[model samples]
Target: MDEIKILFLSHTVDYSKAPYDTGNQFIQALRNNNAAYLSYVQLYNKYGHYGAHHYLKKYVRDNGINCLIYGSSPSEFYFDINYLEKLRKEVFLVMMTGDTEYYYEIRDQYYAQAMDLVTVNDFISTFKLRQIGINSIPYYAYYDSTKYSKNGNLAKDIDVSFIGTLHGGAGRWHNIMHLSANGINIETFGSDSPNGRITFEKKIEIINRSKINLDFSGVSGKTRLTRKHQIYKRMKQIKGKVFEYTMCGSFALCEYAPGLEYFFEVGKEIDIFHDKEELLEKIKYYLAHEEEREKIAQKGYERALKDYAVERAVPKLISIIDGLRKTKTYKPSEIYLDEEFIRNYTTYRTLLIIRFITQLKFKFAFEELKIILKYRKLDLYQIVIFFKEEILDMFPRIKSVLKSIFRRQ
Candidate 1:
């Protein structure tokens, strides 16, 4: 039988209008090649929060799930657990140890249950897993490199560019200080900049043009439960943005991490530094050696396309699932019928309430709905009309909706 691949559970805003949305980009890359029997379902939670954990299990049985992955892209902020109850398949948690120790405990518990654990580094709790006899692997977080190109001439209009929060904490302040003290021509950008956020392509262009783009991560430890201002500090696991910079053919001078040496040969693939001094020295050397710098950028670009894309990463997950099938220890996932009923209740409730109120309002009496529907396409009016017809058949129970929406409620 062919293997099934599901890129599971995303929490991101839509990006149809935005030039770049990382979650949307990930889904795009994973679906790009049409590799495996690939499909996707966005995560759901009740109360407009993360859905029940058991719901995932049931969805699997109904849909015939063969694999599940917790997509571990970086977050500018942390959110609460919402959809744990619905998850059923043996999971693969792709965690990168950063400033937050949020999932450290649950990660160990899940690993103990024969589920595979994938982290970017050999973290502290990772070692503990092996001490107690658990199997896990290091899966490098990947980026879609093809989108970025190494066109002629680097655009260095902006010197010493930086992205990310400016005032999330002290680390950001430190990054600003490091670049300024070095006296490299640099421009500060991101949340710390006058207005936060930049376009994905604009970000890439900025890095390509700048001599060195600073990549620094920030974390606040007080997770509504702590005394320490900075909780967990593992500066090594630099993620998607690093690959992004490289793929654009821009040289990155980033913090040192263990496995990074494998992807990048310290002085070659890109540059790294222990502290402010070491980083400054390398930047000066590379600025003088443009040829060497370009060579390194090309090398990093090659490596990124080869190893850090969806084509390179998805197969690893598939193989692990096949190995698990040989062991055959899991109970097939199952979801109760009420879950579907609840979904129906949830989906239509908000849509109907808004639609009905609009129809019944004086605007229908006062003017054309189109004047108020400027932003909303309301392309699904046919579907809404059909549904409201059903409610209309049921009588006064839904009469309020019609009065409001149709100006009759």
Candidate 2:
């Protein structure tokens, strides 16, 4: 059999600032298992759409790559839809998103229409994409057990722990803060945490040592929208941390969500809580009963090893790409040049143009403000305060401006 040539593309967003990441791991998994020949591409931070297209086309031709895979991205500030449409006839395109709830403001709608196969973690996002005629699969988060495994030497001494941004959880952070205030000791780490940005290996150690690992999937404070700020709506699926905690042989108490039941045996394999009271109660109970916690942790580890490990999940991804290739054959350039494609492509391009203009508007506005501040002879402290308020006030206006423009069109 001829080797399958796959091109893996990902934006730079690493939890661990390692040279290799999940995209590389996926490629490694395929090659390690004698499944495919892969080329990895990390989109350059400074490259524009034209540069990206130029490099991508050259690489694909040079390597004879037949499939393209896009991994998790921190932001979707740039994309080339026309280039993707042109390449669609020659290669199968797959997009994967590990994030579903928080940082959702960064997702691009154009991605749903461009890729041949889309794999998202949550059912809600999958449903939303499928409604737009996209082929979306609910591929839950997976872990490489080799990177995250139980260390016997690490003592399980911590009572409860959470590892993530504290500012983004909306109502959930308030509950955690309340716990901290009430004298219930909880270890934490992340950007918002006092200790600040622990290493991925240290994170695994913390998880293994803690009795219960708290995981939350809630709205971020990025937008000024009141609903995202005030509401405590539960996300429909489990977060990536759930898989990591479970894979590392740690007991997790995640925020209750609908689709988690499909992955785990719930109370048997993993624990979940709906509200602050339940979460606190579970943490207290589990801390006292080390034997029970260990039993649940072992079960979670078994489940993760059997089904959610990268070694197992990568093969399934390969099979899905195979089926996609078989089912979706395309004509040479004609499909992209057709009326439907033209209409869709026009709208997609228009959206990109509008986004570019809005970004430019924000840039010019900030520059003008800086000039005015310089001329006005404003002090540094005054300028800083004014600039902060301007940023906070300008973003919502920028969003509204874009919404109105799109609505008018």
Candidate 3:
């Protein structure tokens, strides 16, 4: 039998000083399994949206890639459905997402319908997608055990620590502040924290050193206007950090999210809190009871190592992928991409282009422009319509006046 040639497309660069992030670890897992001839292409930041899709299709055809795994995100919007439909015939295409809670309705579901299989990070999302007739499976986030493991020598001085960005109005700041106000000596280390962003090694070190590493399942604050309904909603999901914290042999006090119990036994392997009061109570109990804390952490670490380590998880994923390839059928859905949806999508893409240009990212802006021109075919009428909406969006007064005028008409 010929070796299954797989092309993994994702953004691999660690924007921070971290040597390697999750994407790199995932690729390493595939290689370690020796399941297929894996080839990687750094998408998004490297090639923009349209460029990434164009390059991906060409790469797959040229390199005989029978399996294509896309680390899908909402950052890039230029994935032409027609293009995906054609490519699905050639390769067993799969889409993986960790933030399905936020993007599922706005972006992911449309793309997922075109995929041969969809792997989600949370069980609830898996169930939701499957209910809707999509071939979805629970693929929990795995960690590099080499980097994230128990360091017995490191002293657990920090009582509690949260190591992630605090931008999302998803109540992370509120939670941290609430804990601190109630006399919990909490330390935060992320983009908006006092410590700012730290290296990947530093993150792992902190996790190992902290008595209780905090994990918030809330989505990031990077949602679009169309997705405003999700803003500050604090809809929790099974985050990757849940595994990352436990894998370091550290006690993880996570915000309770539905379907988290499927991954770890709450209060046995790990612990969770639903509200601020519960979280505060748990922290106090855990802090005083050092032996109990350590026991839970140890059990969590053992579970993570045995089940969620990249080495163990990847092989299972490959087996599932193989089985899926043999049995799954391609059924593309086009109902979601109506004329109104296209206009909204194009407007969002235009916003991204404007943002890129303002940030002096000319290459990305140019790439977006090229794709918009080619696919959208924006003529005088469409351009006029876009700018009018853009103008109305920018000025509330203008929108009111326009509405009043239309109403008078």
Best by TM-score: 3
User: TM-score of each candidate?
Assistant: 0.63, 0.70, 0.78
Q: Which stretches of candidate 1 lie over 4 Å from their true place?
A: 5-7, 16-19, 31-55, 72-102, 105-114, 119-128, 157-159, 194-196, 217-221, 225-236, 320-409
Candidate order (TM-score):
3, 2, 1
The true-versus-predicted C-alpha distance at residue 107 of model 3, in Å, is 0.4
Task: lDDT for model 1, please.
Answer: 0.51
Give a tens-digit lDDT track for model 1, residues 263-288. Answer: 66767778777666776777788778
* Native-to-model Cα distance after best TM-score fit, residue 272 in candidate 3, in Å: 0.5
Clashes of each: 31, 0, 0
User: Which residue pairs of candidate 3 clash?
Assistant: none
- Which RMSD values do the candidates have, in order? 13.0, 10.2, 7.9
Index of the highest-lDDT prediction: 3
Q: Which ten-residue region of model 3 has the weakest summed lDDT?
A: 35-44
